[model samples]
Target: GERAASAAARAEAAAATADARARGDAEVLARLKVSEAEAELRGARERLAELAGVEMQRQALATELSGLKAGQEERDRAHAAELARLGETFSGLAGKALEAAQAKLAENAEAVLARHREAAGQNLEANRNSLAELIAPMRETLVKYETRLGEVEQARSEAYGGLKEQLAAVASGQRLVSEEAAKLVSALRSSGKTSGSWGEQQLRNTLEMAGLREGMDFTLQAHQAGEAGGRRPDAIINLPGGRQLIVDSKCSLNDYLAAVEAPGEAERLAALKRHAAAVRGHARGLAEKAYWNEFGAAADFVVMFIPGENFLSAAMEHDLALLAWAFDQRILLAGPINLLALAKTVALVWRQEKLADEAREIGKLGADLHAAIATMADHLGGVGRNLGQAVGSYNEFVGSLERNVLPKARRFTEMGVERGKKAVAALPAVDAAVRPVAARELLAPPADDAAA
Candidate 1:
């Protein structure tokens, strides 16, 4: 029993010790797990801090993107406003130009037309005065002839009759010429085709008067192909340096003729207004053709030829802006007088060009002639030097003969080697020298002094 109690006590002690060791091991493991949890919490806090920094960066990027988008929108608005302002400014300028042109035309129309009419009246008066002067001389001559015929009536009766017939025929011819002119004026007012032909004929006459040839200086009814179809200009005048000037003679005269024939003043005024409108219409049509674009070197403006000055004057009287409008359209409204002046100017330009060509040719010939003269002078100088050398040689030969040969011959004569009555003839030395060349070109210093 005692042994049993002792073993039991020992076993109890062992159990208690084992239990304490297990408790210590469990505390150590709990401490280790607590350390691990604390480290995990620290890691979680660091990850949260990183996420906050990313959120801040994302917000900054969004703010920057929004600012860029707003700036872009502002710039687009400014660009659009600028474009609108420029368009408005352009429109205003165009309107102002047109208004100014119209105003200027209105102010000048009446004064210009009045001046033209007054000039026409003066020209008519001058022509009449000239005609009267011519007729007065003819009248005096006829009177003298009449007196002479009466004095020798029987002998010169047939001659007097012939003279009378000749005078009558001349008067008849003058009347015929006047009638033909009237007929031509009437025909011009008859139809469009006739009127166009008349205008072209007048243009031809004006060109001839200006001394422009048909084929050489100008062409009639020239046909040019175009994208639309083809264009036929009435006349294409050749300018200097291969430039061209187009002239159209298709201006209508029907409205102007109607105005002239109108019975009442109101009707005449209405017809004149219509005439002006027709002219404007024609100018617009010509502008659309863009003849300058078709020709490589054509004048910017096309000439619109009106056969009659009256027609143009009447149109301008109603519509003061007719000329200004035509100018805007790049169409020049030229009456007979205006066209003649233009033609004359062109002819003068051609003459000036011809004179320039002739001057160039003359200058070239002068240069060539100068070179030839220089060559001749050089040759003449050479000939002079040769002549001088020959003269010097002749003098030396004469001296040698007098000193050596003549003295020996005279000594032989003195010795009486042979008795001869004929004396030895003395030869004369040449004293003349060749004349030097006097030309300045030959005597001048060499082009390169070192070479000389």
Candidate 2:
């Protein structure tokens, strides 16, 4: 009986294994079918696109055909009018009995009719031919488009199958990611590191991770010089203007986080006081260090960097007394924006110094230019004086020539004038010989009357 039972159990186990193997094979076959369907769908979609584009072109060609038909009708109407006019004109001319009248009329009418018929017929035939030629190509295009549409339908079905598979896969992936993310969030909260303490730790770690070494631009964990009198600040930042600032990383996580865990008016008040005291204490240290004196005693106040903007906000919200206390100590409280402003102010100071130096140099240059201008003015004045003397000398020389030489030239000119007068008197005798006897007698009588 025991052997029989053992054999039956073995047979049952073997049957179960066979059933599982068959199920796996069935799933594989289903996946293969889906993949094949997808490929067919893709091919169909491509063919459908081709068909749609070609169908659009066919519609445009049909529109063009309508326009061509209208043009043909207009041409036919014009040709008919021309033919009618030619026939009327020929009939009117046929009444003339000239020798070649009939022949001429018939010939002219036939020529005009032939030209009109040829033009009309050629235009009509060309339009008809064009329309006919378009028909076969358009039909072929339509056939191709229909074939492509059929192909697209098949491709669409295949695409739908693949889309289903893809959607399922994406759903599965999203579900897995959501589950993992939830778990990670749960773990993070469970570790107690997700609280405000974590943020403080992160901020401090970030600063430390930047390789903030001691005795460079900053000093972390630096001790005070006093043996047992003063407080040793947490971190000291050396500013550009010989100013030193003390920053206290007062992780208000203990108070703030506690207030969150246990909400009460008293707890909040206590947390506020603790944070203010922490900042105030750091402020007092900053004032004592006289960090403002580091930059040639230029700055009148020192800065107290809270590092955490949230902490600064909480402090300001809780009690403005913290800021007041800092002010009393000549300590300026700064968050990130205020800190950046302070840095910019420092940069502006340096820029102002550079500008001042440049201004001084410019002043010197202006003085040098003034001296050069004076020298140039002196030389220009000398040149002007020399030019004036040259002008004066030229005027005097021209005056001397006009005064001394002009009268002598005038006397010589008068002598030549007198000789010319005598020559003019001889001109009358020469004219007398060429003149008629009566004219000469009149001229001699006129000379006596002229003298009188």
Candidate 3:
């Protein structure tokens, strides 16, 4: 814009100068001498030359301005094209990034889904295996219960049969009692010695069969004060806690035999009643003695034992209250069956007592073992430190042998002295026999204790 304005101002000035020169040119031309005319022409030529120079300057300015405008237009077009290309490039890059992101997200989703499905399958299998393991024991237990139910049913049938047989035997007692009655009666009547001795012998036999020791578990004919002193009890059975359970043998088999061999039904019933009364009378006599006071540490009851089960059974059948009446008098009635059960219970008590004592001993042993372990651990720590020192010394010795001794030995070999190949190879390793010892040795009684 400044160049155009300067060109316009130069044209206006040239036109004004041309107009004044045209108006004054004829006057100046007519009045001039040759010399003056020549000078005037030179002046006119100079003005013309100045005008041409001005016009050339105006043209140069116009050309430069036009070139600048064209260059500006070309640059604007190029910048727009470059911006459009950049936009297209950016759009392509964004589209590719979005596609890649979507593909990666899809792959991750598939991998996660696959992993979860596999894990679910594994969990289902594990659950099935666990359920199977859990159910196996329960199934076995159910089978065992079912088998036991069958056994119980069988036992019930056998018990009912046994009950029927017992009832039948009771109904037909004469044949069974006649022979046993004769032998026992003849034995008692012939001699009182045979009677007392054999009766006591019979009692002892039953006790022994029930696992009683003679002196350890019972005493023979333990005499008390008064008339009962001369009359001895069969045994004083020892119980736990320093207490005694007294047993007295009473045989009313004669009355029972009489009842069995009675001629008529009424006589048999009367005899049975007498026999039951006699048994109760004996229990009453034993209780009146109050043997618990005599033994000092005895229980408040006595055991009335009948050597014959048949005699006792007959009496019990005649009078159901006989046993109850005896018990009320601080007396316990016992046949062979009851005595055996009592003995077994006593044996069980002894076993439990032994177990309790062993438990106490084990507790003491455990405390001692703990103390021993603590001492052993202290000893082991000392041993470990000593072993570390020994190992360090061994390593030093080996290093000396390798660095110093073997080199000297090599020189000896040059002098024709030889070393065995096996010995040389064996020097680097230790023996393998030092690992373990026998449990017998570990648990063996100490030599000093054994000797003592």
TM-score rank order: 1, 3, 2
Better of 1 and 3 by TM-score: 1
Please report the candidate that would top lDDT against the real structure: 1
State each model's CA lDDT, in order.
0.75, 0.57, 0.69
lDDT of 2: 0.57
Tens digit of per-residue lDDT, candidate 2, span 1-452: 54355445545544554564477654433344444334334434544555566556555655665565566557556755665565577756654453265456557756765775576567557655655564555465456546645554655566577879999999999999999867754554566445334434443454445444346656664555443454444456555556665554433344544444557788777876676666666567567766444334234665565556776887777776878777888877877556655545544565676698899999999999979976876676577667667666666766776678766766877887443443212111111122233434222356767799
TM-scores for all predictions: 0.54, 0.33, 0.44
Query: Per-residue lDDT for 236-269 in model 3, tens only?
Result: 8888788888888887555677776799999999
Global fold similarity of model 3 (TM-score)? 0.44
Ranking by lDDT: 1, 3, 2
Model 1 residue 181 CA deviation in Å: 6.9
lDDT of 1 by residue, 1-452 (tens): 54355445545544554564477654433333333333333433444554456556556655665665566557556755664575466657676664565456445644554565566556556655655655564456456445533533443454367778999999999999999977866787666788788778999999899889999999999989988788888999999999999999855877787887899999989999999899888888888999998887889999998877988888888899999989988999999899999999999999999999999999999999999998988788788889889989888988998899888987887997884788767778788866665765677676797376
**Candidate 2 regions off by >4 Å?**
1-269, 292-298, 345-364, 386-452
Supply the TM-score for candidate 1: 0.54
Please list the residue runs of candidate 1 whose C-alpha ends up more than 4 Å from where it truly belongs after superposition: 1-186, 228-230, 400-426, 437-442, 445-452
